[model samples]
Target: MKVNVDLRLKDIPGQLVAALEPISKYDGNIRGVVHHHDDRVGGRITVNVIFEVRSEQSLDKILSTWKEGEVDIAKIDAFFETYPIQYLLVGSITSKELESITKGLEAMENVASIEIRYTGTANSSSRAALVTGKASKKETLTTLESFFKQRADKHNYMLIRGLD
Candidate 1:
């Protein structure tokens, strides 16, 4: 079974390794990890780990070990499928508008994560953004593309989708 674990650990040296050791010990194979260093709640950092477990018992043991180590388990999700998407946005897009679009994308059921990169002066009327999102299905991707197209039309921007 593939599992996505969201954990919060104190911002101290070796905290990430300590939290991951239990997963290894319980025979959980790590697939990927996303550490949000820029995001901190109180004194803790949020980390998301994707791994595969052979049995339910192994997953339970890993959770138990996390509790014993004082790692805060924010969430645990069983993920079966996902798809990567990337696109570029051109023409007048402000930070506020970009945030609104990204928030809307994040609210979709199939969407997992959204990342954007933009570089433009405050006074510039023309700006560009590289938008990336992960969706669980092709239908979701179609929906997202439609949403982006509508948003760009409303804002008089150009939406260029990347080839997968």
Candidate 2:
């Protein structure tokens, strides 16, 4: 999993190295690190580290090590796994129908996020939209594709699965 950790460390020499060493020691691959030296408060500075670990267990070890070393952890964010799907829709679909499509897809189980970008003028009757969705499971995306196909058939819209 990819993780972003925000840490507060004392404004003293060797603090950054001490805070980062455990991540490597526990087999975490460091992607980026930003040390905010100027933004100091209460003699401490904030450092942001983005890293990836093989499993949650390895991340837990690094976090515990930091806790033992007295590293003040402010925040941690982990990116969740997602299976993505995209569709190109072209037809005389109305705004109300588009909204209904978005809402129905969002209500599905394991659907993480949905993004829709429309092309052509809104005033024109013929419009195109790129609908992108990410789900926690691949099967969920497959279900979404089936659902979209049904909607497209009923509405007489052209639904292309992949642009290429």
Candidate 3:
């Protein structure tokens, strides 16, 4: 899992190194670190750290170590090998059909989240829906795109896919 964590550390020498040690100790591969040194508040600076860990347990260990050492964590977000997919569906789409499509995508395994935005004209049979989703793996997303393409073909709709 890829994790992004925002931590506020004391603006003192060695605090940065001290804050980073636990992540490496817990076997987290540090990807990037952004230190907001000029934006200190109450003698503390904010650091945004992005890292990949093998499992949730490793992440928990890192967090626990930080807490024990008095580190102030502001935020955390975890991603499971995320891949994005977007499609523009153009046809005579109805609300019920849209709901069914959304439900179908949500039912698939490894699909983290799915969203669709619909737009319709006042004087035409053509409608547009912007479908966006995030999956845990590239293969899962590819499978989803193929399924969507089949649906589009069966319904005689034009499917415009967004560049990966």
Candidate 4:
């Protein structure tokens, strides 16, 4: 079974991973994780973790682990299937930079996965990419904007259909 969890934890180092450790401890493999920031008002951190579980009843252990860790479980959801969206990431290409780009995307809400390759362009040239995600077009676009802005590269976003 695939389940989603919304957890609130202290915005501290290793706290996110600490809260997530129970997923593996409970025999669940994390399929995705998104940590969004809402700093304008309260300094609360929201972490959305998606995992595959062996038994639906195993959620108890997961919930208990969260409480022990002092993490707040805002919500949990089980779904039969996921909604997918695709987007284009076209910008400067570099094997070294892709890691940062990929990590940035993963730390966002609704971004399930990222696939990166390169286009044969010069150093200051651009490349084409395919990013698959489990979010709405709007959500994905917002994630893209945040991820793409970290670097001083020219990245363009073109929403292919079915992302809505």
Ten contiguous residues with the weakest lDDT in model 1 = 78-87
Scored by lDDT, model 3 comes in at 0.87
Tens digits of per-residue lDDT for model 3 on 49-162?
A: 999998889999999999999999988999878788788989877776687788889788988888888888523369999989788777787888888888888877888988
Q: Rank the candidates by TM-score, best first.
A: 3, 2, 1, 4
Misplaced by over 4 Å in model 4 are 39-42, 80-164
Residue-by-residue lDDT tens digits, candidate 1, 33-147? 9999887888898999999887779988998888887899888997556678788988889888888987888788878787988889644678888988677666788888888
Best by TM-score: 3
Of the two candidates 1 and 4, the one with more favorable TM-score, higher being better, is 1
**What's the lDDT for candidate 4?**
0.67
Candidate 3 runs further than 4 Å off = 4-28, 32-50, 54-81, 121-124
In order of appearance, the predictions have TM-scores of 0.50, 0.52, 0.56, 0.45
In model 2, where is the ten-residue run with the lowest total lDDT?
117-126
Candidate 3 to native Cα RMSD, angstroms: 5.4
**Candidate 1 residue spans exceeding 4 A from truth:** 1-79
What is the lDDT of every predicted structure here? 0.85, 0.86, 0.87, 0.67
lDDT (10s digit) by residue, model 2, range 1-164: 78999999998899999999999999999999998888787889999999988778999999999999999988999986677778888887778778988889877898888899997775556799998867777678778888889999998889889632
Flag the better candidate by lDDT, 2 or 3: 3
Cα error, candidate 2, residue 5 (Å): 1.2
Predicted candidate 4 versus true structure: per-residue lDDT over 29-87, tens digit per residue:
89999877762124568888999876666777888888877888788897644456455
